[model samples]
Target: MTAFLSRNLAARASMLASLIFLTACAALPRSGPNKPEIYDGAVERGGDAQVIFVNDHVTRASNFTPAYGFSNSFRNASAVGADEIRAGDVLGLSIWENVDDGLLTSLGASSSQLQQIQVDSGGYIFVPYAGRVRAAGSTPDQLRQVITTRLSEQTPDPQVTVTRVAGDGATVSVLGKVVGQGVYPIERPTRSLSAMLAKAGGVAIEPEIAVVTVKRGNSTGKVWLTDLYAGASNDIALRPGDIILVEEDQRSFTALGALGGQTRVPLGNEMISAIEAIAMVGGLNSNLADPTGVFVLRDEPEAVASKVLGKPVYGSQRMAYVLDLTRPNGLFLARDFYIRDGDTVYVTEAPMAQWRKRIGAVVGTIGSVNSVQNLAN
Candidate 1:
């Protein structure tokens, strides 16, 4: 009776363990069909879900928009050209007269009388004889000529020189994630944004992942540094008091599910196609991935969704995209289909992967039971 009771108890414990394992398997996220039919049926019998099948037609769609453009908010500073001297500029002025000591000339007066003068609100500078000449809106060379003409009236063979001692109004500030941070004087009439970036020791981040911004008073413009260099847009000329910022791109997409490893794929180029993005994450996992069930998940804009859905998808921006790589033409479409930032690229597992998973789980459960039986003995 004691031996019979012990066997009955062991049998009950094994049954209980089997029941627990089955329960756990049923509670898993997905089972049966490894890849859900998101393209044809799941999207069409939709409850606010948008689906796009990436193909030759979809690849040629003009739904993608550039992140940065020459919009009203973004006026290219290069179009405005270089920094010029304005009122409040401090000028270092010196006058020389080559002659015998006359009424206006003294032995030491030429060297001693080099005056540091600020351009007044009226844009004028004062000399001992020249008296309040308009210096505002004039270059140092232009002002020198004006001073020379005025001083020539009283002194014999008068020569004059003008240098900008302080140019607070005619300077650009290089800020944000750059190697150097300081106020750079805009000495030229036209200076490129690239020139300022070079002076600032380039950006801390790689050029591909750097976004260069130009802030001119109330107006501002931003562009990818890669775009700027690739001739997508003009190399904006900097203005006095403009703020140039080099910031991280901060745009990325996620690779999930059956990829080699889940990763955040940085949008390092002007545009990255779906195939390029997959390659960036080391392509999909060979053993586990479903070649026909590759999906690019994105939040479609209302307007873009309308084009794909044949009707307006108003409530939700969610979209699931399927790429059937089994077709010969599918590879071409993948190369052409642009991938936007914040997209989720997911490759569902092969049907065999699920079967393998179930087999592994069963084996593990059986192993656990045998170990328990050993412990009981």
Candidate 2:
């Protein structure tokens, strides 16, 4: 009877050990080391974790500014004064003598002479009788008056007309992943970057991932194409020699942990809220996700961290933002919160769900053992 009791005790101990092991396994996060801890109503900073609560105040964070190309007044000035001539421009010059001709009549060449001349390196064009005439920095009408005044000495009345033949000097280059890659000339009516892009056959890449870079003179700036079209303010006017490039959009984020699917989501031309991003990845796994531990991992700028927390944080290269979806207003805050590029949205497994799964597993193990014992009997 003592041996029988001893064997029964050993069996109970073994069952307890097996249950403990299963419980431990189920309690652990499925996302491995990347899972976020449950968030309470407090801010915690440790190691690489800089945790912040999602609230209305977070909307004021400076880093929330959308990235897109914008032009200052100085850059927009290029759109103005389109009629001004520049060096390297080709001009069509015509001169007519009022009196059927003195010099031109002798040559038997009609009363007028038309010549296509290219502006010289010195910004001047050589006229037949007018000698070196300054054409650069002057409109066609201005150059015509200057030529007529200069030729007054050679002929009693010289009529001069100047027309721009080609604007090789004032043109902007549209290249890089555009449907039509070429140099587009700038005319009197200045064109905006959007107009130039439309003329160039639109962008070849998807707008969300594509960045529009504008190189003007020695300065270079880039902006998301979506931002440019979302607002009129971002579509800066194109300047001469400005290079516009539309390259592949490479911004994306990874959704892991208790999400419905672990995948990389590209940040397209539109602003994506936290809720939108969660929905895009098929939301959280109902059986395993912790409602209070919805975390957005981001490599936040130090300054942004300082502003959001209202104090300086130390030793964090990235931030771990937690949202408690169990609260009445938690869903509202999630909808308002925006996700940045390279952010990781992680939903930790609920503790109770882990317990339930472990119980089921342990029960199944016991049933399997009982079935084997029955067969042995």
Candidate 3:
């Protein structure tokens, strides 16, 4: 069937691409985990990598974004003026009452009636007699003037005040690598973002640097929460109604068979390449690892099938990108292939691995049965 061939071709192609992943991952020094220096210290790639060549062929390339004056649509300039107050904002109401000496029952500085006025849905607040004064769009000082003037009608001079309520709005959801998971209470309107995090007990250990995200509505922005903690980031202020989310740590992923620590790594928002991903997970156990076959089983067979069939039978369909990471140029491409939440990167075992394990299981079962028979006899 036409379907079957495409399926087989796709499978072969993926295996081959993974072949690139393995080959590329192997060239670096395998001293052990915590080899940040190996990748970052400028190493040369002079040796030949045993890359498995298959019908599948794709190469990738890219570089880091430039700093200064370049407009990244994702990172917008901070908002100004009343444009900052989003919906669901809770404001603080501070009232200063100048009590009349006559009305005070021997009490000094007593309020005429109520002290503070609460703002409503329409951004207006009604004081004791200053009924329905607009305050939402109005600045704190401006609102204060409005209240004072209105109260002046009753008292010769009524001292009034207005301020945003402390901690009365939506909260940030801290996911992945924190001790607690939920929306944290933000009591102050003008508090620094670091203060909000301090309220929720800061980030976890070795938290992925530059991997935190703040997502809301249609707007998603990236920040290095790890860097924020280490005093490396300047973009640390959290806006009103903003969600400050921490990404999952990197040590939660699974590395099977040949890997030293076969575990699941939590997904973070760092611009990390596949080579970097492999290094993050304790590197491969050289004795059991086959450099020519490091494969990342990210996509399922079903999805690859759809892609294959959708390709034109006449022209070359773009299968998928498999980079020869041994090349310096390949690292550039890996940076752009940003990984999202819940992505899986696998390192496949050697060809004869499963068969050996299967055979061992069968032999062990047979030996157990024979021993049982002998004991019965």
Candidate 4:
């Protein structure tokens, strides 16, 4: 009777444990949803996001790679002369006459020096006898000719020389991520975008991730700092009243789920592949991550979405691209796949991981029941 009672109590305990396990199955701890759950969420009617498998075909169809490069306006622009004069410029004029008592010269001096002769807003400068010669549009040598001619009518063989002292007329403001930040004059050595950056003591950020922007009036252009030497066309001419900004690349993507790290990763190169992005976050969590359920989520532009789905899509569509690393060409596909800014790279939890949690929970419950029965005995 004792043995039979013991058997009955054991069976009752087993039954109770099974009931508790079933009731608490949904409450098990998990890092994130498993593969099946993600699929179900994607396929539901009016789903929040669509899931598409990553393959060579899909990679080729989705052509939404964004990069920084100058437009035609910047590429086609011609370099301006460094010595070109403009209004608001300060000039230094020297005048010498053959006669000792020359026009506007003292009895003992044969040459006269005019320091800091500022060009007026009307692009003209007043000379003793030249009478408001237009200096803003003329180069130093050109202005010299005009002044010499005007003075020669009154004074025989007047020698004139014009020198640019300083000016705010033809200057560019360099700001952001540069060794030096200030208003720089566009001279012969610093007339182009690349040259002007050097004048500002080069970019302070890494060249691989530096972005250079030039704004002139209503137009603006941008390009990677490394591309400045990639081609001559990218070395655009600098214009007066231009604003040049050198900054670190602002493009980044977020990594979530079962990965070594969960954070936003910045682009370290001009272009980065999906594999590179995964590595940036320390790859997948080997013990808990589902190798077959990696996903890249992004909002696809209308044109790219239409091509990717082979159907017309209106506006920006939410897309989730799946990558199965277990497939034969999975790693290769990932290597070629490109990651865009504002993308979410997620890896689902392995199914076995959840099962392990459930097993642990059931084992703990059964141990508790055994302890209670022993106390009652």
Candidate 5:
């Protein structure tokens, strides 16, 4: 009877252990939500996000390719004259006369040197004999002509020269990620965007990821630093009061789940594909990664979302794009697929990996229960 009772107790313990294992399966420790869980939480079923497969058709339909180039206004802008005068400019004037006691000369000196004559806000400069002369809109030669004409009425054969001295007018403010940041004068050699960037000692960041922005008056435009030199049309003309900013590319995507590493990967080049992004994060985890369940999550713009889903979606729509690397053309599609900024790359755990964890948990529980029963006996 004792032997039969012992056998019954053992059976009961095995049953209880099975019950415990079943109960704890739901609380298994996982890196992230599995594939089915993600699908069940999609927007089509009143969830927070939508799921789509990455393929050739979807790639062609969605137009989210971002490239850097200037607009027509910025590209077609004519270069400004380097010697042109503007307000707030300082001019160095010299006047010579035939007689020593001329209008601009002294008793012993035949020439008079006027140093650092600043142009007023009204675009006029005050000369000794030639009243207020408009010097802002005119070049040095034009201003010299005006000064000579005005002084000729008082003194015969008057010679005048106007030279632009150091001033804030007709200059561009170069700031941000450049070797040298300062207000650079727009001379003949530095009249274009490329020339001005060189004048500022080039961009401090990598050329492939560098961005150049130009704010001219109320209009603003931007282009990749590499693109600036790729074509002449992108080499926009620089204007006075222009603010040129060079900065590193801010585009990046987050890598998560069963990858080799979980971190934010920057777009070091103009364009980076999904495969490249995965490789950047040290590729997938060999032990736990599900090659068929790699996903790229993004809050796609309404236009791109609409085209992707073939329906109108208002505002930004949350989308999760699945990439199955096991397919015949999966790697090719991933190579063609581009990763945008603020995107999340997730790789789900393999089914066998979760099973392995469950098996481990059950075996550990069974061993603990056997030890307790032995002690009780």
Candidate 6:
């Protein structure tokens, strides 16, 4: 190579290197970045739970049931009652020989609505006579012992009778966020949570989504609906008056951007890209859209922290992941950006666009007031 040609090529290369370095410096940014933070929550709690106000109007406790992704760890939340009584629930009521013969005959004659029987609003049947209540909350054997003790108190030698005239009144209600939400009566008493869910319509027919939650009344935890239904009796044996709810998966989003119209976007996974999400929202109005300050605001900002450490934690450090969409390859980084529920994909109007909107608003106000005065005159 000749010396002059080599010198010229070197100069061009030097200029290119300087330009590249300056660009890198511009990207480097002089300001310090925010800290990386984590959360201690699961995605299911509103995609990770930090409950603010229970929506008495929009949602009730039942809405949080398996019917609504709210699981009923009821067994874990509270104890399960015994499960061995049927339609023929019997009660033996008798007193000691102090009991008049006429009284004994009258008992046999009337067969009253149950001797000193009290039915709790929960449907538990309690009898106070032989003190042996079979259907209220006792198994056959438990009632026998109670009757024996009552006889012992009344007569040194006592005879007790047992018979079930009424059926069980335990019902597991399925409600909210489900295709079929109503009260389901359980007769067998040996049915499981799965059986109850099946009776409650399983899950609704929705595409690209499948998940069921069972929430107990005591706590805001959940059990998988399918796991309960893997088989008729895989787990979760139920009782009378238990509550089971089935809920649809609420994992979706909407992408609103600069376009002819807004779009409601459905997301299948946890992650979405700015470029792709924009496309899903019908792309931008290239003629007027400003891609510089494309800001994505996620829902439940408080939930981001606990999601990192695996629980609801403070999010003071992790404000949010901000991205610049103007660069050519910044689209790649958008893929890693996870869009959560209730997230807002806001595209700021360019300066010209904002000015146009303000002008239109002012003109509309003037036109309205002028029309009002003209009508009055």
- The best candidate by lDDT is 5
Worst 10 residues of 4 by lDDT: 40-49
Higher-ranked by lDDT: 2 or 5: 5
- Alpha-carbon lDDT, every model: 0.73, 0.75, 0.47, 0.85, 0.87, 0.48
State each candidate's clash count: 2, 6, 17, 0, 1, 43
Q: Give the alpha carbon lDDT tens digit for every residue of 1-377 in model 4.
A: 87777777777777887787886687876666777777776745556777899878899987478767888877887776767788888999999999977887899998999999888888888998779789887889999998999998999998888899548788899999999999998888888988899888998888988888899889888888888879888899888899999988888999999899999998755577888888988999987899898998899999998899888978888888999999999999999888988989999888888888888888888897787567445
Clashes of 3: 17
Off by over 4 Å in 5: 1-23, 370-377
- TM-score for each candidate, following the candidate numbering: 0.80, 0.76, 0.50, 0.90, 0.91, 0.48
Candidate 2 similarity to native, TM-score? 0.76
Candidates by lDDT, descending order: 5, 4, 2, 1, 6, 3
Candidate 6 per-residue lDDT, tens place, 348-372, comes to 4565664565555555545654554
Model 3, range 281-341, lDDT digits (tens) per residue? 7775655554444443232233332343443233322222233334555455444443333
Model 4 spans with C-alpha error above 4 angstroms: 1-24, 368-377
Winner on TM-score between 1 and 6 is: 1
Question: What are the per-model C-alpha RMSD values against the true structure?
Answer: 4.1, 5.5, 15.5, 3.6, 3.2, 17.7
Write one digit per residue (lDDT tens) for candidate 1, span 128-176.
8877799877778888888888777887778777877545666789998
Worst 10 residues of 3 by lDDT: 61-70
Give lDDT tens digits, candidate 2, residues 1-377: 86676667667666765776666565643564433333322244335455676777875673474465654753455463677788888888777776654655555554565566888768888877778888999999999999888889888877777888546777889989999999988764447878888889999877767788888777788888887788777777776788888897777878987888999998776678888999999998998888788888887777787778788865444667778898999998888888888888888878777678667766766776565444433
lDDT: worst 10-residue window of model 2: 33-42
Best by TM-score: 5
Q: Candidate 5 — what's its lDDT?
A: 0.87
Compared with the true structure, what per-residue lDDT tens digits does model 5 show for residues 1-377? 87777777777777878787987687888789999999997977779998999899877765376767778888787888878888878999989999868876778998999989988878888997789889888999999999899899999989888899646777899999999999988888999999999989988887988899999888888888877898888999988899999988788899999999999888765577889989988999999999999999998888889988888979998899999999999999888888888899999999999998898889988996797567445
Error of 1 at 356 (Å): 2.2
